[model samples]
Target: MGLFDGYNIASSGMGAQRTRINIVSANIANAKTTHTEAGGPYKKQNVVFEELLVNNTKNLNNNLQETNNKNTSAELRGVGVKSIVENDADPIMKYEPSHPDANEEGYVAYPNINPVVEMVDLIEAMRSYEANVATFNTHKNIDSKTLEILKA
Candidate 1:
Protein backbone atom coordinates (compact mmCIF):
# COMPACT_ATOMS: atom_id res chain seq x y z
CA MET A 1 0.00 0.00 0.00
CA GLY A 2 1.12 3.51 -0.74
CA LEU A 3 1.97 5.87 2.08
CA PHE A 4 -1.29 7.79 1.72
CA ASP A 5 -3.52 4.76 1.22
CA GLY A 6 -4.02 4.39 4.95
CA TYR A 7 -5.11 7.99 5.22
CA ASN A 8 -7.54 7.57 2.34
CA ILE A 9 -9.04 4.44 3.84
CA ALA A 10 -9.34 6.02 7.30
CA SER A 11 -10.90 9.18 5.92
CA SER A 12 -13.44 7.13 3.99
CA GLY A 13 -14.29 5.22 7.13
CA MET A 14 -14.75 8.46 9.05
CA GLY A 15 -17.04 9.83 6.38
CA ALA A 16 -19.19 6.70 6.34
CA GLN A 17 -19.42 6.57 10.12
CA ARG A 18 -20.26 10.26 10.27
CA THR A 19 -23.12 9.64 7.89
CA ARG A 20 -24.31 6.75 10.03
CA ILE A 21 -24.19 8.92 13.15
CA ASN A 22 -26.24 11.59 11.45
CA ILE A 23 -28.86 9.08 10.40
CA VAL A 24 -29.05 7.68 13.90
CA SER A 25 -29.42 11.16 15.33
CA ALA A 26 -32.22 11.94 12.95
CA ASN A 27 -33.97 8.72 13.79
CA ILE A 28 -33.75 9.49 17.51
CA ALA A 29 -34.93 13.05 17.01
CA ASN A 30 -37.99 11.96 15.09
CA ALA A 31 -38.85 8.94 17.13
CA LYS A 32 -42.10 10.43 18.39
CA THR A 33 -42.91 12.31 15.23
CA THR A 34 -46.53 11.61 14.36
CA HIS A 35 -46.58 13.05 10.87
CA THR A 36 -44.40 14.30 8.10
CA GLU A 37 -44.82 16.10 4.79
CA ALA A 38 -44.91 12.68 3.20
CA GLY A 39 -48.31 12.12 4.88
CA GLY A 40 -47.27 9.70 7.56
CA PRO A 41 -45.13 9.30 10.63
CA TYR A 42 -41.45 10.01 10.23
CA LYS A 43 -39.66 6.92 8.93
CA LYS A 44 -36.40 5.96 10.56
CA GLN A 45 -33.45 6.40 8.23
CA ASN A 46 -30.37 4.20 7.80
CA VAL A 47 -27.06 4.66 6.08
CA VAL A 48 -25.95 2.06 3.57
CA PHE A 49 -22.21 1.63 3.19
CA GLU A 50 -20.44 0.32 0.10
CA GLU A 51 -16.88 -0.26 -1.00
CA LEU A 52 -15.25 2.49 -3.01
CA LEU A 53 -13.23 0.82 -5.76
CA VAL A 54 -10.06 2.00 -7.40
CA ASN A 55 -10.58 3.01 -11.03
CA ASN A 56 -7.47 1.24 -12.33
CA THR A 57 -8.36 -1.99 -14.12
CA LYS A 58 -5.18 -3.72 -13.05
CA ASN A 59 -5.72 -2.87 -9.42
CA LEU A 60 -9.33 -3.94 -9.65
CA ASN A 61 -8.42 -7.30 -11.17
CA ASN A 62 -5.68 -7.86 -8.66
CA ASN A 63 -7.97 -7.02 -5.80
CA LEU A 64 -10.56 -9.45 -7.11
CA GLN A 65 -7.96 -12.21 -7.54
CA GLU A 66 -6.60 -11.57 -4.08
CA THR A 67 -10.09 -11.87 -2.65
CA ASN A 68 -10.61 -15.14 -4.50
CA ASN A 69 -7.33 -16.41 -3.12
CA LYS A 70 -8.24 -15.30 0.41
CA ASN A 71 -5.24 -13.01 0.57
CA THR A 72 -5.07 -10.17 3.08
CA SER A 73 -2.60 -8.12 1.06
CA ALA A 74 -5.29 -6.65 -1.16
CA GLU A 75 -5.65 -3.09 0.02
CA LEU A 76 -9.20 -1.83 -0.19
CA ARG A 77 -9.75 1.44 -2.01
CA GLY A 78 -12.08 3.00 0.55
CA VAL A 79 -15.60 3.12 1.88
CA GLY A 80 -18.59 5.17 0.81
CA VAL A 81 -22.15 5.78 1.77
CA LYS A 82 -24.16 4.04 -0.93
CA SER A 83 -27.50 5.43 0.15
CA ILE A 84 -29.67 6.67 3.01
CA VAL A 85 -32.78 4.58 3.07
CA GLU A 86 -35.97 4.99 5.07
CA ASN A 87 -36.86 2.07 7.25
CA ASP A 88 -39.70 -0.06 5.94
CA ALA A 89 -40.67 -1.24 9.37
CA ASP A 90 -44.19 -0.47 10.40
CA PRO A 91 -44.76 2.52 12.61
CA ILE A 92 -45.51 1.95 16.30
CA MET A 93 -49.07 2.72 17.23
CA LYS A 94 -49.93 4.02 20.65
CA TYR A 95 -53.32 4.66 22.16
CA GLU A 96 -53.59 8.39 22.59
CA PRO A 97 -57.21 9.34 22.41
CA SER A 98 -56.73 13.05 22.97
CA HIS A 99 -53.62 13.43 20.85
CA PRO A 100 -53.99 15.73 17.87
CA ASP A 101 -52.56 13.22 15.38
CA ALA A 102 -54.56 10.26 16.63
CA ASN A 103 -56.60 8.28 14.17
CA GLU A 104 -60.32 7.67 14.53
CA GLU A 105 -59.46 4.58 16.52
CA GLY A 106 -57.63 6.77 19.02
CA TYR A 107 -54.25 5.44 18.00
CA VAL A 108 -51.32 7.66 17.12
CA ALA A 109 -48.69 6.34 14.78
CA TYR A 110 -45.17 7.07 15.96
CA PRO A 111 -42.02 6.60 14.01
CA ASN A 112 -40.68 3.06 14.06
CA ILE A 113 -37.61 4.03 16.05
CA ASN A 114 -36.41 2.86 19.41
CA PRO A 115 -34.38 5.33 21.38
CA VAL A 116 -32.19 2.65 22.95
CA VAL A 117 -31.47 1.08 19.61
CA GLU A 118 -30.70 4.44 18.04
CA MET A 119 -28.47 5.32 20.95
CA VAL A 120 -26.56 2.08 20.51
CA ASP A 121 -26.15 2.74 16.81
CA LEU A 122 -25.00 6.27 17.53
CA ILE A 123 -22.38 5.02 19.97
CA GLU A 124 -21.13 2.44 17.51
CA ALA A 125 -20.85 5.02 14.74
CA MET A 126 -19.07 7.43 17.05
CA ARG A 127 -16.57 4.78 18.13
CA SER A 128 -15.93 3.82 14.53
CA TYR A 129 -15.40 7.44 13.60
CA GLU A 130 -12.99 7.86 16.51
CA ALA A 131 -11.07 4.78 15.44
CA ASN A 132 -10.78 6.15 11.92
CA VAL A 133 -9.55 9.45 13.26
CA ALA A 134 -6.95 7.64 15.34
CA THR A 135 -5.85 5.70 12.28
CA PHE A 136 -5.54 8.91 10.24
CA ASN A 137 -3.52 10.59 12.99
CA THR A 138 -1.24 7.58 13.26
CA HIS A 139 -0.60 7.69 9.53
CA LYS A 140 0.14 11.39 9.68
CA ASN A 141 2.62 10.83 12.50
CA ILE A 142 4.33 8.05 10.57
CA ASP A 143 4.57 10.21 7.48
CA SER A 144 6.03 13.04 9.50
CA LYS A 145 8.62 10.72 11.06
CA THR A 146 9.55 9.37 7.63
CA LEU A 147 10.05 12.93 6.36
CA GLU A 148 12.23 13.73 9.39
CA ILE A 149 14.33 10.63 8.82
CA LEU A 150 14.78 11.48 5.17
CA LYS A 151 15.85 15.02 6.08
CA ALA A 152 18.47 13.72 8.54
Candidate 2:
Protein backbone atom coordinates (compact mmCIF):
# COMPACT_ATOMS: atom_id res chain seq x y z
CA MET A 1 0.00 0.00 0.00
CA GLY A 2 1.06 3.60 -0.61
CA LEU A 3 2.16 5.78 2.31
CA PHE A 4 -1.02 7.84 2.37
CA ASP A 5 -3.17 4.72 2.65
CA GLY A 6 -2.03 4.38 6.23
CA TYR A 7 -3.12 7.93 6.97
CA ASN A 8 -6.47 7.36 5.33
CA ILE A 9 -7.15 4.18 7.31
CA ALA A 10 -6.07 5.71 10.59
CA SER A 11 -8.13 8.85 9.98
CA SER A 12 -11.22 6.76 9.38
CA GLY A 13 -10.64 4.80 12.59
CA MET A 14 -10.11 8.03 14.54
CA GLY A 15 -13.32 9.51 13.23
CA ALA A 16 -15.38 6.43 14.06
CA GLN A 17 -13.98 6.12 17.57
CA ARG A 18 -14.46 9.83 18.20
CA THR A 19 -18.11 9.45 17.29
CA ARG A 20 -18.43 6.43 19.56
CA ILE A 21 -16.92 8.36 22.45
CA ASN A 22 -19.33 11.24 21.88
CA ILE A 23 -22.30 8.89 22.02
CA VAL A 24 -20.99 7.21 25.14
CA SER A 25 -20.59 10.61 26.78
CA ALA A 26 -24.13 11.53 25.90
CA ASN A 27 -25.45 8.25 27.26
CA ILE A 28 -23.59 8.70 30.54
CA ALA A 29 -24.71 12.29 30.88
CA ASN A 30 -28.35 11.26 30.53
CA ALA A 31 -28.23 8.11 32.65
CA LYS A 32 -30.41 9.64 35.37
CA THR A 33 -32.74 11.46 33.05
CA THR A 34 -36.34 10.64 33.87
CA HIS A 35 -38.01 12.95 31.44
CA THR A 36 -37.24 14.04 27.90
CA GLU A 37 -38.90 16.15 25.22
CA ALA A 38 -39.83 12.92 23.47
CA GLY A 39 -42.34 12.20 26.31
CA GLY A 40 -40.45 9.75 28.47
CA PRO A 41 -37.01 8.91 29.85
CA TYR A 42 -33.84 9.31 27.79
CA LYS A 43 -32.67 6.45 25.58
CA LYS A 44 -29.09 5.35 25.27
CA GLN A 45 -27.45 5.84 21.88
CA ASN A 46 -24.67 3.87 20.20
CA VAL A 47 -22.61 4.31 17.09
CA VAL A 48 -22.32 1.85 14.22
CA PHE A 49 -19.51 1.60 11.69
CA GLU A 50 -19.23 0.02 8.26
CA GLU A 51 -16.14 -1.11 6.39
CA LEU A 52 -15.41 0.34 2.95
CA LEU A 53 -13.72 -2.56 1.23
CA VAL A 54 -14.20 -3.12 -2.47
CA ASN A 55 -17.29 -5.23 -2.80
CA ASN A 56 -16.46 -6.55 -6.27
CA THR A 57 -13.68 -9.11 -6.30
CA LYS A 58 -14.04 -9.57 -10.04
CA ASN A 59 -13.11 -5.99 -10.72
CA LEU A 60 -10.01 -6.35 -8.58
CA ASN A 61 -9.02 -9.51 -10.41
CA ASN A 62 -9.47 -7.84 -13.79
CA ASN A 63 -7.39 -4.89 -12.69
CA LEU A 64 -4.63 -7.19 -11.53
CA GLN A 65 -4.54 -8.96 -14.93
CA GLU A 66 -4.15 -5.77 -16.93
CA THR A 67 -0.67 -5.27 -18.38
CA ASN A 68 1.61 -2.31 -17.62
CA ASN A 69 -0.78 -1.24 -14.88
CA LYS A 70 1.37 1.23 -12.98
CA ASN A 71 -1.61 3.11 -11.57
CA THR A 72 -3.29 0.14 -9.93
CA SER A 73 -3.03 0.28 -6.13
CA ALA A 74 -4.76 -0.85 -3.00
CA GLU A 75 -6.54 1.77 -0.98
CA LEU A 76 -8.61 2.11 2.13
CA ARG A 77 -11.91 3.76 1.22
CA GLY A 78 -12.43 5.01 4.78
CA VAL A 79 -15.26 4.17 7.15
CA GLY A 80 -18.74 5.58 7.69
CA VAL A 81 -21.03 5.61 10.71
CA LYS A 82 -24.15 3.61 9.90
CA SER A 83 -26.37 5.22 12.51
CA ILE A 84 -26.93 6.38 16.06
CA VAL A 85 -29.52 3.98 17.28
CA GLU A 86 -31.45 3.97 20.53
CA ASN A 87 -31.62 0.85 22.67
CA ASP A 88 -35.01 -0.86 22.49
CA ALA A 89 -34.77 -2.44 25.93
CA ASP A 90 -37.16 -1.23 28.56
CA PRO A 91 -36.12 1.58 30.87
CA ILE A 92 -35.46 0.93 34.55
CA MET A 93 -38.38 2.00 36.73
CA LYS A 94 -38.02 2.71 40.41
CA TYR A 95 -40.54 3.30 43.09
CA GLU A 96 -40.04 6.92 44.03
CA PRO A 97 -43.19 8.10 45.78
CA SER A 98 -42.08 11.70 46.26
CA HIS A 99 -40.59 12.13 42.79
CA PRO A 100 -42.35 14.67 40.62
CA ASP A 101 -42.65 12.37 37.58
CA ALA A 102 -43.82 9.38 39.53
CA ASN A 103 -46.87 7.64 38.10
CA GLU A 104 -49.96 6.54 39.98
CA GLU A 105 -48.10 3.33 40.91
CA GLY A 106 -45.26 5.40 42.44
CA TYR A 107 -42.90 4.24 39.70
CA VAL A 108 -40.54 6.69 38.03
CA ALA A 109 -38.92 5.60 34.79
CA TYR A 110 -35.24 6.24 34.26
CA PRO A 111 -32.91 5.65 31.36
CA ASN A 112 -31.67 2.10 30.80
CA ILE A 113 -28.09 3.30 30.61
CA ASN A 114 -25.50 1.86 32.98
CA PRO A 115 -23.05 4.58 33.90
CA VAL A 116 -20.22 2.14 34.63
CA VAL A 117 -20.64 0.38 31.32
CA GLU A 118 -20.76 3.72 29.54
CA MET A 119 -17.62 4.80 31.32
CA VAL A 120 -15.92 1.60 30.25
CA ASP A 121 -17.05 2.20 26.70
CA LEU A 122 -15.68 5.72 26.94
CA ILE A 123 -12.31 4.41 28.09
CA GLU A 124 -12.25 1.92 25.21
CA ALA A 125 -13.14 4.57 22.66
CA MET A 126 -10.52 6.92 24.06
CA ARG A 127 -7.88 4.19 23.85
CA SER A 128 -8.86 3.32 20.30
CA TYR A 129 -8.72 6.99 19.31
CA GLU A 130 -5.27 7.30 20.84
CA ALA A 131 -4.07 4.18 19.05
CA ASN A 132 -5.29 5.51 15.73
CA VAL A 133 -3.58 8.82 16.34
CA ALA A 134 -0.37 7.05 17.17
CA THR A 135 -0.64 4.99 13.99
CA PHE A 136 -1.19 8.13 11.90
CA ASN A 137 1.76 9.83 13.54
CA THR A 138 3.96 6.82 12.87
CA HIS A 139 2.96 6.81 9.24
CA LYS A 140 3.64 10.54 9.03
CA ASN A 141 7.07 10.13 10.55
CA ILE A 142 7.86 7.32 8.15
CA ASP A 143 6.75 9.42 5.21
CA SER A 144 8.89 12.30 6.38
CA LYS A 145 11.92 10.09 6.81
CA THR A 146 11.40 8.60 3.37
CA LEU A 147 11.21 12.08 1.85
CA GLU A 148 14.40 13.09 3.65
CA ILE A 149 16.18 9.99 2.40
CA LEU A 150 15.05 10.72 -1.11
CA LYS A 151 16.35 14.27 -0.81
CA ALA A 152 19.70 12.98 0.42
Candidate 3:
Protein backbone atom coordinates (compact mmCIF):
# COMPACT_ATOMS: atom_id res chain seq x y z
CA MET A 1 0.00 0.00 0.00
CA GLY A 2 1.03 3.62 -0.57
CA LEU A 3 0.90 6.63 1.70
CA PHE A 4 -2.28 7.94 0.10
CA ASP A 5 -3.87 4.53 -0.11
CA GLY A 6 -5.37 5.00 3.35
CA TYR A 7 -7.15 8.12 2.14
CA ASN A 8 -8.64 6.24 -0.78
CA ILE A 9 -9.82 3.39 1.42
CA ALA A 10 -11.29 5.67 4.07
CA SER A 11 -13.01 7.87 1.53
CA SER A 12 -14.54 4.85 -0.11
CA GLY A 13 -15.83 3.65 3.23
CA MET A 14 -17.30 7.08 3.88
CA GLY A 15 -19.00 7.02 0.53
CA ALA A 16 -20.49 3.59 1.13
CA GLN A 17 -21.68 4.56 4.57
CA ARG A 18 -23.20 7.72 3.20
CA THR A 19 -25.08 5.66 0.66
CA ARG A 20 -26.35 3.35 3.40
CA ILE A 21 -27.46 6.33 5.45
CA ASN A 22 -29.38 7.71 2.51
CA ILE A 23 -31.10 4.43 1.86
CA VAL A 24 -32.05 4.04 5.48
CA SER A 25 -33.40 7.57 5.57
CA ALA A 26 -35.47 6.88 2.49
CA ASN A 27 -36.87 3.68 4.00
CA ILE A 28 -37.78 5.59 7.15
CA ALA A 29 -39.46 8.37 5.20
CA ASN A 30 -41.53 5.94 3.17
CA ALA A 31 -42.38 3.65 6.06
CA LYS A 32 -46.02 4.64 5.99
CA THR A 33 -46.37 5.11 2.26
CA THR A 34 -49.08 2.92 0.83
CA HIS A 35 -48.92 3.90 -2.80
CA THR A 36 -45.92 4.20 -5.05
CA GLU A 37 -45.29 4.57 -8.77
CA ALA A 38 -44.67 0.83 -8.85
CA GLY A 39 -48.34 0.33 -7.96
CA GLY A 40 -47.88 -0.91 -4.40
CA PRO A 41 -46.54 0.04 -1.05
CA TYR A 42 -43.01 1.47 -0.87
CA LYS A 43 -40.42 -1.23 -0.48
CA LYS A 44 -37.60 -0.92 1.97
CA GLN A 45 -34.33 -0.37 0.18
CA ASN A 46 -30.91 -1.66 1.19
CA VAL A 47 -27.43 -0.62 0.15
CA VAL A 48 -25.13 -3.43 -0.80
CA PHE A 49 -21.42 -2.94 -0.33
CA GLU A 50 -18.60 -4.61 -2.22
CA GLU A 51 -14.87 -4.57 -2.18
CA LEU A 52 -13.33 -2.03 -4.57
CA LEU A 53 -10.39 -3.63 -6.29
CA VAL A 54 -7.78 -1.76 -8.30
CA ASN A 55 -5.56 -3.53 -10.77
CA ASN A 56 -2.15 -2.32 -9.72
CA THR A 57 -0.01 -5.08 -11.17
CA LYS A 58 3.11 -3.00 -10.84
CA ASN A 59 2.62 -2.48 -7.13
CA LEU A 60 1.63 -6.07 -6.57
CA ASN A 61 4.62 -7.42 -8.46
CA ASN A 62 7.00 -5.04 -6.70
CA ASN A 63 5.74 -6.04 -3.26
CA LEU A 64 5.88 -9.73 -4.12
CA GLN A 65 9.41 -9.43 -5.44
CA GLU A 66 10.57 -7.44 -2.44
CA THR A 67 9.11 -9.88 0.09
CA ASN A 68 9.92 -12.94 -2.02
CA ASN A 69 6.36 -14.06 -1.43
CA LYS A 70 4.07 -15.11 -4.27
CA ASN A 71 1.04 -16.32 -2.34
CA THR A 72 -0.93 -13.09 -2.50
CA SER A 73 -2.08 -11.90 -5.91
CA ALA A 74 -3.74 -8.58 -5.17
CA GLU A 75 -4.53 -6.06 -2.45
CA LEU A 76 -7.88 -4.91 -1.14
CA ARG A 77 -8.21 -1.48 -2.75
CA GLY A 78 -11.28 -0.07 -1.01
CA VAL A 79 -15.02 -0.31 -0.52
CA GLY A 80 -17.88 0.51 -2.89
CA VAL A 81 -21.64 0.17 -3.19
CA LYS A 82 -22.47 -2.89 -5.22
CA SER A 83 -26.17 -2.15 -5.55
CA ILE A 84 -29.31 -0.79 -3.91
CA VAL A 85 -31.93 -3.49 -3.73
CA GLU A 86 -35.45 -3.54 -2.38
CA ASN A 87 -36.24 -5.71 0.57
CA ASP A 88 -37.44 -9.11 -0.54
CA ALA A 89 -39.40 -9.67 2.63
CA ASP A 90 -43.16 -9.50 2.31
CA PRO A 91 -44.93 -6.33 3.36
CA ILE A 92 -46.86 -6.22 6.62
CA MET A 93 -50.60 -6.48 6.10
CA LYS A 94 -52.73 -4.49 8.49
CA TYR A 95 -56.48 -4.48 8.72
CA GLU A 96 -57.57 -0.93 7.99
CA PRO A 97 -61.02 -0.96 6.42
CA SER A 98 -61.21 2.83 6.14
CA HIS A 99 -57.79 3.25 4.54
CA PRO A 100 -57.87 4.28 0.90
CA ASP A 101 -55.25 1.75 -0.14
CA ALA A 102 -56.85 -1.07 1.76
CA ASN A 103 -57.62 -4.22 -0.16
CA GLU A 104 -61.09 -5.67 -0.61
CA GLU A 105 -60.46 -7.78 2.52
CA GLY A 106 -59.75 -4.58 4.47
CA TYR A 107 -56.04 -5.35 4.72
CA VAL A 108 -53.50 -2.70 3.77
CA ALA A 109 -50.06 -3.79 2.75
CA TYR A 110 -47.60 -1.61 4.57
CA PRO A 111 -43.93 -1.49 3.68
CA ASN A 112 -41.77 -4.12 5.36
CA ILE A 113 -39.96 -1.49 7.34
CA ASN A 114 -39.42 -1.23 11.07
CA PRO A 115 -38.73 2.27 12.27
CA VAL A 116 -36.55 1.14 15.18
CA VAL A 117 -34.44 -1.03 12.92
CA GLU A 118 -34.06 1.76 10.39
CA MET A 119 -33.03 4.20 13.09
CA VAL A 120 -30.46 1.77 14.42
CA ASP A 121 -29.09 1.21 10.94
CA LEU A 122 -28.93 4.95 10.42
CA ILE A 123 -26.92 5.41 13.61
CA GLU A 124 -24.53 2.64 12.63
CA ALA A 125 -23.95 4.14 9.21
CA MET A 126 -23.32 7.54 10.76
CA ARG A 127 -20.78 6.07 13.15
CA SER A 128 -19.06 4.23 10.35
CA TYR A 129 -18.91 7.43 8.31
CA GLU A 130 -17.47 9.31 11.27
CA ALA A 131 -14.82 6.64 11.73
CA ASN A 132 -13.85 6.91 8.09
CA VAL A 133 -13.59 10.67 8.37
CA ALA A 134 -11.34 10.27 11.37
CA THR A 135 -9.17 7.84 9.46
CA PHE A 136 -8.90 10.29 6.57
CA ASN A 137 -7.99 13.14 8.87
CA THR A 138 -5.34 11.02 10.57
CA HIS A 139 -3.81 10.14 7.21
CA LYS A 140 -3.85 13.79 6.18
CA ASN A 141 -2.09 14.83 9.36
CA ILE A 142 0.56 12.15 8.94
CA ASP A 143 1.22 13.20 5.35
CA SER A 144 1.54 16.84 6.44
CA LYS A 145 4.02 15.92 9.12
CA THR A 146 6.04 13.85 6.69
CA LEU A 147 6.19 16.74 4.23
CA GLU A 148 7.28 19.12 6.99
CA ILE A 149 10.09 16.79 7.99
CA LEU A 150 11.18 16.41 4.37
CA LYS A 151 11.30 20.20 4.02
CA ALA A 152 13.62 20.41 7.04
Candidate 4:
Protein backbone atom coordinates (compact mmCIF):
# COMPACT_ATOMS: atom_id res chain seq x y z
CA MET A 1 0.00 0.00 0.00
CA GLY A 2 1.15 3.49 -0.81
CA LEU A 3 1.13 6.44 1.57
CA PHE A 4 -2.09 7.83 0.02
CA ASP A 5 -3.80 4.54 -0.77
CA GLY A 6 -6.36 5.09 1.96
CA TYR A 7 -7.61 8.27 0.26
CA ASN A 8 -7.95 6.48 -3.05
CA ILE A 9 -9.84 3.63 -1.43
CA ALA A 10 -12.26 5.96 0.32
CA SER A 11 -12.77 8.11 -2.80
CA SER A 12 -13.49 5.07 -4.92
CA GLY A 13 -16.22 3.99 -2.48
CA MET A 14 -17.73 7.48 -2.64
CA GLY A 15 -17.77 7.45 -6.42
CA ALA A 16 -19.39 4.03 -6.57
CA GLN A 17 -22.06 5.05 -4.06
CA ARG A 18 -22.73 8.22 -6.03
CA THR A 19 -23.34 6.14 -9.13
CA ARG A 20 -25.68 3.94 -7.13
CA ILE A 21 -27.63 6.98 -5.99
CA ASN A 22 -27.97 8.18 -9.59
CA ILE A 23 -29.26 4.78 -10.69
CA VAL A 24 -31.83 4.71 -7.88
CA SER A 25 -32.96 8.23 -8.78
CA ALA A 26 -33.42 7.24 -12.41
CA ASN A 27 -35.43 4.20 -11.38
CA ILE A 28 -37.70 6.30 -9.21
CA ALA A 29 -38.15 8.95 -11.87
CA ASN A 30 -39.24 6.37 -14.41
CA ALA A 31 -41.34 4.34 -12.03
CA LYS A 32 -44.62 5.42 -13.63
CA THR A 33 -43.35 5.82 -17.16
CA THR A 34 -45.58 3.66 -19.32
CA HIS A 35 -43.69 4.04 -22.57
CA THR A 36 -40.17 4.61 -23.82
CA GLU A 37 -38.20 4.92 -27.02
CA ALA A 38 -37.21 1.30 -26.48
CA GLY A 39 -40.83 0.41 -27.44
CA GLY A 40 -41.96 -0.32 -23.89
CA PRO A 41 -41.93 0.97 -20.37
CA TYR A 42 -38.53 1.94 -18.91
CA LYS A 43 -36.79 -0.84 -17.06
CA LYS A 44 -35.56 -0.28 -13.54
CA GLN A 45 -31.79 -0.07 -13.39
CA ASN A 46 -29.37 -1.29 -10.74
CA VAL A 47 -25.68 -0.79 -10.01
CA VAL A 48 -23.31 -3.68 -9.55
CA PHE A 49 -20.35 -3.05 -7.28
CA GLU A 50 -16.99 -4.74 -7.59
CA GLU A 51 -14.03 -4.95 -5.28
CA LEU A 52 -10.59 -3.98 -6.57
CA LEU A 53 -7.56 -5.86 -5.35
CA VAL A 54 -3.97 -4.69 -5.20
CA ASN A 55 -0.89 -6.92 -5.15
CA ASN A 56 1.63 -5.19 -2.96
CA THR A 57 4.80 -7.28 -2.89
CA LYS A 58 5.47 -6.65 0.80
CA ASN A 59 1.88 -6.80 1.85
CA LEU A 60 1.26 -9.97 -0.10
CA ASN A 61 4.19 -11.71 1.61
CA ASN A 62 2.96 -10.56 5.00
CA ASN A 63 -0.61 -11.68 4.35
CA LEU A 64 0.63 -15.06 3.09
CA GLN A 65 2.03 -15.79 6.52
CA GLU A 66 -1.48 -16.17 7.89
CA THR A 67 -2.09 -19.60 6.38
CA ASN A 68 -5.59 -19.87 7.79
CA ASN A 69 -6.78 -16.51 6.48
CA LYS A 70 -9.57 -16.80 3.94
CA ASN A 71 -8.47 -13.85 1.80
CA THR A 72 -5.03 -15.25 1.03
CA SER A 73 -2.76 -12.41 -0.09
CA ALA A 74 -4.76 -9.96 -2.16
CA GLU A 75 -5.04 -6.48 -0.65
CA LEU A 76 -8.33 -4.60 -0.85
CA ARG A 77 -7.55 -1.71 -3.22
CA GLY A 78 -10.80 0.13 -3.92
CA VAL A 79 -14.42 -0.05 -4.97
CA GLY A 80 -15.80 0.20 -8.48
CA VAL A 81 -19.08 0.03 -10.36
CA LYS A 82 -18.89 -3.24 -12.24
CA SER A 83 -21.98 -2.51 -14.32
CA ILE A 84 -25.43 -0.98 -14.45
CA VAL A 85 -28.12 -3.44 -15.44
CA GLU A 86 -31.83 -3.16 -16.13
CA ASN A 87 -34.19 -5.33 -14.16
CA ASP A 88 -35.33 -8.35 -16.22
CA ALA A 89 -38.47 -8.95 -14.23
CA ASP A 90 -41.78 -8.58 -16.05
CA PRO A 91 -43.28 -5.12 -16.25
CA ILE A 92 -46.13 -4.12 -13.97
CA MET A 93 -49.36 -4.58 -15.86
CA LYS A 94 -52.24 -2.25 -15.15
CA TYR A 95 -55.73 -2.19 -16.67
CA GLU A 96 -56.05 1.18 -18.35
CA PRO A 97 -58.35 0.96 -21.31
CA SER A 98 -58.29 4.71 -22.01
CA HIS A 99 -54.49 4.96 -21.98
CA PRO A 100 -52.73 5.38 -25.32
CA ASP A 101 -50.10 2.74 -24.52
CA ALA A 102 -52.68 0.19 -23.40
CA ASN A 103 -52.58 -3.19 -25.08
CA GLU A 104 -55.50 -4.56 -27.03
CA GLU A 105 -56.55 -6.35 -23.85
CA GLY A 106 -56.78 -2.93 -22.12
CA TYR A 107 -53.73 -3.47 -19.93
CA VAL A 108 -50.79 -1.05 -19.83
CA ALA A 109 -47.25 -2.06 -19.07
CA TYR A 110 -45.66 0.01 -16.31
CA PRO A 111 -42.07 -0.26 -15.27
CA ASN A 112 -41.73 -2.88 -12.52
CA ILE A 113 -40.54 -0.41 -9.96
CA ASN A 114 -41.89 0.61 -6.60
CA PRO A 115 -41.42 4.17 -5.36
CA VAL A 116 -41.00 3.02 -1.77
CA VAL A 117 -38.27 0.58 -2.70
CA GLU A 118 -36.46 3.17 -4.78
CA MET A 119 -36.62 5.66 -1.93
CA VAL A 120 -35.13 3.11 0.44
CA ASP A 121 -32.34 2.35 -2.00
CA LEU A 122 -31.69 6.05 -2.41
CA ILE A 123 -31.41 6.49 1.34
CA GLU A 124 -29.03 3.55 1.61
CA ALA A 125 -26.85 4.89 -1.16
CA MET A 126 -26.75 8.31 0.41
CA ARG A 127 -25.74 6.84 3.73
CA SER A 128 -23.00 4.81 2.12
CA TYR A 129 -21.73 7.88 0.30
CA GLU A 130 -21.70 9.81 3.57
CA ALA A 131 -19.70 7.06 5.23
CA ASN A 132 -17.13 7.14 2.45
CA VAL A 133 -16.87 10.90 2.74
CA ALA A 134 -16.22 10.53 6.44
CA THR A 135 -13.44 8.06 5.72
CA PHE A 136 -11.84 10.41 3.23
CA ASN A 137 -12.05 13.33 5.65
CA THR A 138 -10.49 11.29 8.40
CA HIS A 139 -7.61 10.42 6.12
CA LYS A 140 -7.15 14.07 5.28
CA ASN A 141 -7.13 15.04 8.94
CA ILE A 142 -4.57 12.39 9.77
CA ASP A 143 -2.31 13.52 6.98
CA SER A 144 -2.65 17.13 8.07
CA LYS A 145 -1.71 16.30 11.65
CA THR A 146 1.20 14.24 10.48
CA LEU A 147 2.51 17.17 8.47
CA GLU A 148 2.08 19.48 11.47
CA ILE A 149 3.97 17.08 13.71
CA LEU A 150 6.75 16.69 11.19
CA LYS A 151 7.17 20.49 10.97
CA ALA A 152 7.58 20.66 14.76
Evaluate all candidate structures by whole-model CA lDDT and list the values in order: 0.85, 0.82, 0.86, 0.85
Candidate 2 per-residue lDDT, tens place, 1-152, comes to: 66567887788789999899989999998999999998899999989776554323233234454423667655445565768999997999999999998999999999998898999999999999999999999999989999999999
Using TM-score as the yardstick, the better of models 2 and 4 is 4
Give the top-scoring candidate (lDDT): 3
How many residue pairs clash in each candidate at the backbone level? Answer: 0, 0, 0, 0
Lowest lDDT block of 10, candidate 2: 53-62
Question: Lowest-scoring 10 consecutive residues by lDDT in candidate 3?
Answer: 53-62
User: Per-residue lDDT tens digits of candidate 1, residues 42-76?
Assistant: 99999988776643334344466666676455555
TM-score of 2: 0.83
**For residues 41-138, what per-residue lDDT tens digits would candidate 4 score against the true structure?**
99999998866643333332344555347766546667778889989989989999999999999999999998998999999999999999999999
TM-score of 4: 0.85
TM-scores of the candidates are 0.85, 0.83, 0.85, 0.85
- For candidate 4, the lDDT comes to 0.85
lDDT of 3 at 77: 69
